[model samples]
Target chain A: MSDSPVQRLFAEPGLEWRSVSPKLTIERRLPLLGLLLFGLALLAFGRFVAEQSEAAGADLTGALFSGLAAAALVGAVVGWFFVVPRVVSAWRYAEREQDLLVSRGRLVRRLTVIPYGRMQVIEVSANPVSARLGIATVTLVTASASTDARIPGVPVDVAQELRDRLAAKGEALTAGL
Target chain B: MSATDAAPAAATQASASASTLRRLHPLTPFFRSWQLVGALAASGFGVFRDDLDKLKWIWRALHGDVEVSLLMRAVGVLLLVALALVFVSWLSWRVTGFAIITDASPSGTLLYHRGLIVRQRSQVRLNRVQSVDVNQPFLPRLCGLAAVRLDMAAGEGASVNLAYLRRQDAWALRAEILRHTAVARSRPTAATDSTEGAGGELIAEISTARMVQANLLDGVVAWVVLVVWVVALVVGGVVFGWRGLVTVAPGIVPVTVGIAVQLRRQVASMMRDANFRLRRTPTGIQTSSGLTSTINRTIDLDRIQGVRLEEPYLWRRLGWARVGVDIAGASDQSHHGASLMPVADRRDAVALIAEVTGARLDEAAVVPAGAQARWLDPWVARHLGVELLDRGAVTRWGRWRRTQFFVPYARVQSVSARQGPVQRRLGLATVYLDMPSGVQRWQAQHRDMAEAAALVGELAGQARLHRAPLRRLEPTLGTGDR
Candidate 1:
């Protein structure tokens, strides 16, 4: 914790960075739940096809695929309990005087600082689960394709506010790409 | 042209008034179909080669041993094919035309119409044009004709090539197009350069000897390795005889064929331009080169985002280097067409880049990738590092070619720092300075994590400073042109 590079990289003195809503964890895991359901359906479909072809002799292939599917299901459950929380916690952003700084990721830390003038567009989106959870995703589009500056798990109203503020700042500093 | 920046209030009326489209020169079809005619003739000769063996058929026909009707039939067929090709080319030329139109935007648009039945149209905003070139292919040059190629700020296939314009008309069109581009086309850069005078200064001219030397040096390393490989194989063949030759034949065939193909390609590209010359022009920098079919290109200084200087190991002793640029506008399909100088003295090349783009070249200021990076790059790590300049940034790398890239901040599209798990454990990261697509990439690989992180803000800040004053600086100069 003391030697965290994310803190070292973006920790401007007296800066209080804004952290996204923690309820984001539940909304993020819904994808894993949907994936788990799809995997079960696929497993059953595979077995049904194997049974239709030869019934008895396909046991080895069936068991192998079943084992792989089971392992993946277990991994997803574990990530739902563990990985999702940390990733959701990692979404932090700070509005600077001239730029907006966003940082995420625990193991592979990512810090992106986009100048207000460089912003081409700001998009706020939400999935059904995210809508229910009152959370939205904010993406900052720049001329550079690789910017990939998106802050997820933001409170819906706050996301809208962030968009307006960013758009206003961008207009104020308006430099064309 | 003043109407280009005029208000968008009369957009409809402007486009209507400029609706009159102009066609290319009347000889467009003849000149454009010359290559097709040549191919048809070669194939005809190849097909009738047996009958025309040493002109025996000619002697036989004269004595009436051969039928004249058969010869007439073949000649008629050949004539029919050539005529059809010319007709098709003529149709296309008739359908193709261009017009300059101003729409709802403050900037003007170039409308190109082509295709006979389908009738396709493409509109390009005049402001996005990066560079314009006047190209005269050999046959066209002989006919006193040229092609105007406009490179936009878009990606691949972004070049709009209008061919077979009269030579002087091509130049006039290029000048007319530039007048509406983003640079405002008013003034040239400050002439604090060696060649003196304002613009049209002869910066560098690649001589025949230097061109040959640079080409040979480019392949010297690969040629040496290939020679050594062949020698070792020969020694093995001698020791092992027939059995060895058979076993090695498979490897030998592909390697030999591959080297030959690569060498041929290198030679062709190297000889593409014979007398390369770089000159300062009123609107930007002008580069004219080629043995036949002279090509004249103007690259606006404002559109240049980065410059790359490459010095091969063999070229180092001769103090020769190649300079290329990353344009803010759309890059050509093959960036080889974007070189400022094919081969020039290192000192002169450096001075030219500084004079034009104001990119300072100070190798000592760059900090090298630390000793630990040897585990990754081994040889090039020592050469890899980055330095920040007030106006731009410079990065040095490449083990053999020794490439140095100078990216001015104003042209930087984005800056990013990335670290994988291994780099994280080692406290290292790589930072890349993003430019427009199709440009050569520039980055500092495996540097101290802290330094790379600091660079993210610092690099972006430098861009802000450089681009702060004015985005519409007409003919932007290097010493804070605003």
Candidate 2:
């Protein structure tokens, strides 16, 4: 597989680097699962409408039903195969001396950097499935709930260790500085 | 007089000793247990119904054939009641404990105890305390008991609850906290020798006139929205189920009346809670909500990310303005800077603007210069894109309100540029310059794209300058006082 080119690229200036477990496929692909579920729901709704139209003894031919079915199938297929991998590959974290950087998104690149010392909390949360898979999520809460940044799919052990380290480091920085 | 005073003092001591303040409510566990059991029973009904329905047992229970099972059901219910009572009573007995331990050492802390079966202790230190909130529910007011919550800056979900405190004790504790925090901030120490001296700034309290401004929506926009919502609901009901008029009449009228009553109560409560006061410590200025549970927030003057003043069509007619601040605090409920004022009086706005920016608005200053006029005048002209024909000029004073404000450019912490579809179509954008304090929210509306971009660039430069390296400031100056 020509050793994924992603592993060779290094971070540039103004970027901090953090690593998420490469093995965390299921956890990292959660958004894909959500898309899949939505597509399936839409498909079912379209089919139900089609059946209702037929039972009413009318030649209920509508573009909406067909269009929705096609859209659902396309969404399901694309999300499952194409979007998930691209999203995971682009996902990276960087813990700089100044800020914690999280960069992701395939087409529209989004890079969020929150200054480290200003971080209010480092909360480590793990679901049972994630724990079984040896991954945990770390949410770095700022004063604002809406803008809080979470880095999920981190290896469970590393996540906990990072949480403790960040909490201690952040508090010390505030107290000492 | 001495003998009579002694007798009265002894009687008073006896009565005070007999007071229940030292004791925890015995029904604490009962209330908890009742809530738990009620929730469980309601859920159980939903869970167990599937199997019972499959076997048609529910149908049998509803008919006369239930006679045979009636005795068993009655016995079962009685047993459940008895079990519930025993469990709740025992838990209440075990969990109920109340003790207020006040420690006046340098640590300055308060201790609270409650619970019978499962005892709980909440320890709150004075230094960690951010604010003390006392709430009086209808029942608590009648009982002369209030729920006091101490919010600490330790992070989220870090509050010590003194569930039931006498009204007097709650007030006393709040006052004590305020005094202690104030003393700690003002006190100086060698370690904190680097900070600058305190700058005196006046923050106007919410006067009755201000309160009226804050609730100006009572007669205008609020009523219109409410009426529209009610009308919509009634129309929907009539269209959907007009055949069920007789049965629906009983439900709709009461529901509508209940909604109206609830709205009235909400408005009244919000008005009562519309108190605003500026709280300042050595660290920074904080303008937070008072009186109401919905809008409580504390924003450090330095951390304000953006500010905007909104004057809707109706508000403009009413000579009012609403100010909103954007802070790091979770913006959903609290810490979202938004408030109403009946009259945007220049003096009041100027005073608020001064407190936030650490600069005074000098009266008789040249138009939009020296202090606020310098930045605000150009800010309004360049950013607001005021045409000569347009009355919304660079001047701080509005035609109706005649209020003026002078906010400095350097105090701005953040600037936001936003343009909606309509604004884009109109070739206009809105610019917001956020100040760290609760005042000096400068909004320039309907600016041309070029002007907005230029303002954004200028504000960005100012923000960068203001955001100096924390290390540059002497840490000792701000610390040892506490």
Candidate 3:
């Protein structure tokens, strides 16, 4: 790192950056488990078809089907064991005095900031799987198409509170209009 | 017989009587209904011609001779359709009318009412009027008429339009409205009557010679023609060998010429503003331009959320740049109305920038990023730098197309510091400033991590101070003034 005094002067200004709940990791992994089951089912179906084809003396078709199914199964295993954990760990958000910042993505990281005054709507949503996992997602709708920000894997109660706070703040800020 | 005694009596008499409602020009319905007339005529002719052919065929089968009755029926049908079209146009002309009502209250609310079936009555307080536009389409221009569009700060149904007025009438009405708005805002109007002074003091203008040079420098036609010709040659050679080249060779010339012509036309349309002028007024800046349909728009000073100074690759060597602003009420994504200066020299560009944004242009020193900063953005590192001013911040970045962004402390909606995995390893971070909605993306990527952190804190504090609502003192009224 460059030790220029200019750089050192601006380092770490004592602001807390908040991470999401730890239980979000388990909630994210649950989808991968379902994906693994689907892949295995697909492999079983392909093998059954291959066995029938072989009995009918179509050896080439049987080999082709078996090879394709094996590749899919391998892809599913690697994705579940490798990609999910890293992506979930990268997800983080923090609420500042006037805006909310959400940053995610491991390789092509993107950071989106949405100001409280610009927000037109705040929504809290939960699907069956996420509801069972006790997690929800909060979405912010702004006038600009590009500034929409969403926070996923938030605890259910926290999502509601966040939505209420954001809506109230947005109202207070735009009251000047 | 005193003048003051007669003025109060006349004011009361006018207010007691109903305001007059004005109708558009008699030719307005003809202009508005021409599209419908043309569509009906075409469809009517097509259907009648087909039916005539079928009737002739039937006549031949039954009587062993084609009949003239079929042609007569077709003519009758065409005439009936034309009559229906004229009737609809008459109804539309009769129903559409607009009125400007001056309310009795001191605030002077202007009520604009217009429509055919569902009436739309919009009340605009004089102080809320931001700008006015006078547009003349090709057909309307032929008849020396124009439409006036009023832009206000209110939400849905805020825009009030008065269409199909004489061009001179439109200008007079615009001036009258502006005069009332100025008075409402407590601004003096002694010099506002002068035509040249209406646009305020001149800041810049695009010369004809400079325009031609800029067009050539843009190279839009060259790039398009080259891409088309190269693609044709490569595809022909790869797919069909020597024979393919021979076959496609004849089409290459026409295709290249067609692309060049289309691109040239597009460039001309974009540069149609013959005398592009920018001026500064007391309340804001006004820009007027266009060769045929002149557009004069005024942007209030406080409405400008952000400004972007761009030096594209072609113009960089010539020291030319363009400036655009994000205005509060402008909802159009094309940003045609947001152009501050289409093209100018670096010196003038910087001067205009300083005029719009209170921050100084040359205060920021260029701080180069370390070589390792290339991991995040390869093209951005060489030119990336940020200057934090007392009241705002300016960030410069990009290689081929350099950009300098200015965001005032009060306008900045949010600030974020980002450190990706690669950036974390390199001890660098990217900082972004979220301006109010409608402004494009503004960010400084690949900066030293420490500096990025310091920027966030400093910007946040400054923003809070500037964002605090200023208490306005009420104007004290004198007993004798009223």
Best by lDDT: 1
Model 1 / residue A117 / CA error / Å: 0.8
RMSD values for the candidates in order, in angstroms, are 5.9, 14.2, 8.2
lDDT of each: 0.74, 0.49, 0.66
Report the lDDT tens digits of candidate 1 across residue range A82-162: 899988887788888888877777777676777787787899999888899999999988766667589999999999888
Which residue ranges in model 1 land beyond 4 Å of their true spot?
A3-6, A10-13, A38-63, A127-133, B1-20, B34-82, B99-111, B121-125, B156-158, B179-185, B188-199, B225-252, B333-337, B438-441, B469-482
Better candidate number, 2 or 3, judged by DockQ: 3
How far is B43's C-alpha from truth in model 2 (Å)?
17
lDDT of 2 by residue, A1-177 (tens): 223212212222444466666656676566556766776776677677666776553334435655665776687678667876676676677765544556555553333444454465678888877888888888876433333366878888888788887877676544111
Task: List clash counts for every candidate, in order.
Answer: 3, 30, 0
Error of 3 at B338 (Å): 3.2
For A62-132, candidate 3 gives per-residue lDDT tens digits of: 56656766766676677666766677776777777776767676665556666676566788887887888
Ranked by lDDT, the better of candidates 1 and 3 is 1
TM-score of chain B of each: 0.80, 0.51, 0.77
Model 1 chain B weakest lDDT span, ten residues long: B473-482
Docking quality (DockQ) for each candidate: 0.35, 0.05, 0.17
Q: Indicate which candidate wins on DockQ.
A: 1
